[model samples]
Target: MAMAFQSILPTLPCFLPASNLPDGIDAPAVARGFATLGAWSLDDFTSDAMWRDSVALTGTLRTFYSAATVSAGWTERCFARQVHAFQLNPDAARVVRPAPGLGWINIPFTFATNTPTTTCSGFVSLVRGEGGWKIWLLRTILEQFDGYPNVDEPPQQPPVPIDGAEYECVIVGCGQSGLSVAGRLQALGVSYVVVDKVSQVGESWLQRYESMKLHTPRETSHLPFGRTFTDEYPEFLSRQDLARGYQAWAEKYSINILFSTELVSGSWNGDRRRWTLHLRQNGEVRSIACTHVVMAVGAGGHEPVRPHYLGEDIFQGDILHTAQYNNPHQWRGKRAIIIGCANSAHDVAEDMVEAGLASVTMVQRSRTCVIPVEYMPTRAADTITTADRNQYSAPLALNWQLSRLHIRAQIEANPARFDALERAGFRVDRSGDVFAHVHERYGGHYLDVGNCANIVKGLIQIKSTSPNHPIRFTPSGLLFSEGSNDSHLPADVIVFATGFKQNVRDTVRQLFGEDVYDAVDDYWGIDNEGEIRGAFKPSYHGNIWFLSGTSGHSRYFSRFIALLIKAGVEGVEVPVYRGVPGKAHEVEEVGGRGRGRGHKN
Candidate 1:
């Protein structure tokens, strides 16, 4: 059975002892071997390589340097240093004990150069082979602007008293969105605090279904200004690896995060030009103030939907949402019916069958665009989605214009991907590549990662959500409609993979009231500027901003949001780049909460 990672990789002072590691292997020595490569000249490293087969860049490394750059190893800017120091993180080294003789260990490292004063954060994967521990993967992302933080220090020191410390920004939801924003804010030297409803870092990843994985490649999902590689590349990231990385990232920057906390309510005090937030931790509530609020909650996975059903309360069998499902093995030998068809639905269905369930059926409420993971080049998505830290550091209009072109290419490539989905029964209108279809529509498609194969192999059954074949719960099981046909499927479990309601207004109303909620535009859509509707721009409410998107977007755009907040605070003019072609930029006044026409829940 898959278990929650109670103890992470062993650390010098903290991580519990790692299981399955060969005894007496020096970890710091192994770390130095990889650093040698990262500091080497690009030509010598790639021209006559030693042990290239074992090397692969993690998502974090790939985003900064492509495979070619990784092959080159080090950039021209980096060379042999005068005072060399490498710190081996004991608790942060993740062990991959697939087998006794065939296991690999992943270690995260940070090194500093003396002459030029450069610092880098990276991970090295080492395998225990005949020649002792050898380097398998060496990938690092250099921090050019700010030095890596004193990782020994804790960021928030959980349950630590806030004591009415006024912050410049208060970020809610410490998942990818929150952490990514914090990284950017930290790099920009913003006075802020990040708080999550969960007790621990990356509990969002841990609480997912046992088989849940990143549908996207690993390279694009890194936290801003930090290393985000997994133990292996191309392969889906494990919850354990992700959890450990997040913990390490939190430590590296000491990004201020208060876990086991909740922002019960927040209201913008117009008179004081700040937001008063009710923060609840350990059953005690305290009020804190901040000039800006970033709802860093992800675009999805919030406010999950348990679809209304007749007699749902009286259903004898177990009823659950995909968000709450973690153990499919526990439901072994039971008949299960999962409603809604998407990534979660397919993952849950396949997991049930693999866990030795008696039967499983999936009901498709609407067509989903299905794309193969292998369709794009390995890490191709990152090239388009990732904002070049240097490039984006330029003027905002130029950065977005480049972004617009990159996204257009993805949209143009949609026909082929959509054609494949149309051949699989997705409606013509619902077909597009990830950008034009999946991320833009919230989700109208599933990134096939061996999902369609299960349906083809008859391991999982499928049904429709058409009104003609409406699903009705009987005393024993479910009666599903199949066009003009009706069939009874005995189910001991009913799992709803129904997606979340993207109602930012409803969520905002609870804290700031209906007036503030109404001040924002529709939570999501392509605006007149061709940029995303709610992100990186002012929502209808001036002081009120919505910061929710993929991690790559957060890494790239959060800097702009920080600049906006900074401009607003320092009484400087913020050039409003409306993202429209041939239009001159306009300077907007940077104070007061401006209202907009937005939707109500």
Candidate 2:
């Protein structure tokens, strides 16, 4: 039946009229105007119903009435009026002629309409053999409301440059590690320059929250060259105190630090045995050549990450991550929800609770092992003799031997104490395969000995809600999967204390490009039979060395990194681990492959 109807249709003509559009009006303008008005181009108007629909949709008179008044069937009336107005053009009538082997013939024409308030127009005509006609292509001009204006002044030219600049070493990043490296190099009589992207030393620490304080004690966290918080504050230092210490250290040592300078790229000039650093400073790009380059850009330098979730876009209240958490003052009287149960989450929760927030709820994803800071032994209070200092300075062999002896003595003196504490509900776990149930019951006084007692006590309510059960998700946040059950808890704000990725690889790739990875892979030197170093791979060229790439070991990071820098400068093989003298054998056996241990070259 469809084939029979097709045989009865009229045929098209051979020739059709060409377009009358002006030269300045380009193809885009014609298309845009046709698209804006209620008209279809010749290409699109072949289908009668589709052409009618286009005309109805873009008509100006229809738009005016629809915008000015609301009436039933207004859309149908607008479409009808647009079709009638389209039929008024003589050019539109002639172009509807039919052509051979086609459904319609083509006739091109240009016309202008003032009702739409547009400037240009063009159209294609189609002619049918039996006398039916309609437009196939229709277009109108789009005027430019804003024209080009006169320019003011010409651009300036760059000045010529001089040569013959020399530097012994150029260190990038002015954080704790960078300053330590520079100080050690200076003591060794090596000339060096320290540069940081920020405007001041320790500005990175200043960016942290107001309640932020060092997790480790000041005595263990001090830099080399004898500059320490103990010289001033005998306890843990606050964020402000840490910043001041960094500033004073830089001033006291007269460490040459080029502030607000960033190293964009660097290359090893094999011919000159030096590194050529392309640097960006004060909107100007410059180059510096140095014999040695030490990168001390610390961990946690990148931006914080927040995962996408349902209805996140529709969230009506305040939402912020730990990176933006300056203080708890704004949240003092507001309800807050802390997401994730890592160290940062716990610390932030404590801060908010202490600041007198109306209500604070911790949404923990997983159970975490918490170790009290005081559990770790403190440095002896009395001044050490020269012999004791020397003993501390000896190689890993003697250091580890003595440390093992000390650890053994402590263990012997407290043989039944840990067992007794476990029986009394202390909930402590060791670092090996033995998983012993330490505590049968948990009570408020269980955390009395720890400084974070309030935070630990808050866990009691959450723990009582579900004995040995994991919370999967609440009306507010989700919990980590443990054995089988799924659950959720309700809260206000969610904070993820879930730590950062080891970003040295990313930083290296961004600064040096991917080619460096090829060299790193070839020189990694990890024994296949033994465990790999994970992320750290040291590279050296003669006496010059690069010591930036390392993995995600958080505990003892600053100290280990300082020791590595010290070893690089002294031209010695970097030790597998840093420990007390005369205990290397025991330390090597237990510490080398332990959690957080990195393989050495």
Candidate 3:
């Protein structure tokens, strides 16, 4: 199916001076109009049959009204969480064109039942018709998190700290992925503890090379509930800055994190549907029990990949992988040869050259999709890819689809970025956009800041050859493949920027047992149900879960993971939601079908 979509921009009269709304849509007026309809929905929860009604709701309101009862427990306290979540600007309204004829804005609201502490969140779209606007579509988004159970401080039942800890949930890996999940779990009042192998929270970023800076912009990469960071960092932040921010986020939220902890083994309790994890802290073995266990360790750190060469023993010099690469301060006059052509390789080669290396060469083993940092605008998608779709308020799946369509267009529009590099024997791939390429093959791409410029300017040597080319070691340096023009390149240091073991299943197996590993070995790929296999969704294994991806993704989808875990803890029946209920339509154009990208680099 074509995954194309259009981002709607609304227009209202300019005479309205009371509010200055972006795209000229009277957001406050639209909000007030939906509030009136929200009250009316309580009683007149009726609409004409299906899509032919005076106001259409895409069947969400009909399905909600058909329910046997809507309220539960003590007094029904309702809360309105603005549906403009898709837009960063609070004053702007999220507009969408579900059908060619209908333009609706999502007005998300939630209601809570205090007794059992359950919440239901959804949205109502105010349709812009011939007579101003009227409430059209109403739907349920999520049951637990979006249900608005608390206001001042979120609803949370503090974890019970104890020796040989037993808890409802144990979140492993204290990186951003784990911290994001911990925040969501804490907000839901779920009893969960976060554990990591490092000594501090932001060690992951701090451990990277000193010169590393995020390729992504500051606003899009911001953590959930931390808008302050976006302002503090208007551009890409340094690794040290990111580390301090991570430590501060954990501190500000009172996140429960256990550092210097290693999981020796995890055994599944078939009868109880829980996990008994054996952990080692300070060289002492201890056991912790929990109903659910979330693995937050990503493919990047699970295992470093070191491809073998023919005669590595002949070379007597330092050859380090990018994983252990700290800085180039020592390799001042050394002849360094960086293997692999991905981002790390380019970055490392650039670092060597800038560090005043005698010579730096980057071997391009495969084709890669390289895009500049401008691909991600401060705002959302620029041109609408499909008329049937909307970017502001679509289901995440559909949004992913639309995003790919939009990004593909951006690449197609600009050919100058890759043309010269390709002419210079560089294999630039247009098989898909950078986003899809990353998900499909983690190997192909670098979001260039300076490396490409150096490659073009003859500052960095480029060798376009197969990754498995024969490499033999010589006493002085190394010999390249016989087929290549340059048979030898003297090098004192070789850094492998090759990828790591991305199999989440294998990584999980190493932490748990084979049985646990077997349960989720087929980790990444499209599943039978059409959902992305393994990460946020439940794996083949029960209770065991995965949390991996960029920080923004972790921030957004952590709620779903927390809700599922929360369901198990509270013993509440989770209602079936067919992909975040909304009016965003699927792309009708077949040509628009493509892959997508994540928020983080």
Q: Report clashes for each candidate as comma-separated counts.
A: 8, 46, 6
Best by TM-score: 3
Query: Which of candidates 1 and 3 reaches a greater TM-score?
Result: 3
lDDT of 3 by residue, 449-538 (tens): 778888777778877665435367776676766553547778888888887777677666677767676656354433322234566644
lDDT of 2 by residue, 458-509 (tens): 5311321223333333444434344475444444555655444433445656
TM-score computed on alpha carbons, candidate 1? 0.65
> Which pairs clash in the backbone of model 1?
10-90, 10-91, 11-90, 11-91, 59-219, 369-445, 469-481, 542-594
Query: Model 2, stretches more than 4 Å misplaced?
Result: 1-166, 303-310, 380-451, 459-488, 521-601
lDDT of each: 0.57, 0.42, 0.57
- Model 1 misses residue 300 by how many Å? 5.7
TM per candidate comes to: 0.65, 0.52, 0.72
Worst 10 residues of 3 by lDDT: 49-58
Cα-lDDT of candidate 3: 0.57
**Model 1 C-alpha lDDT per residue in residues 388-419, reported as the tens digit of each score:** 43333222222233333444345466666555
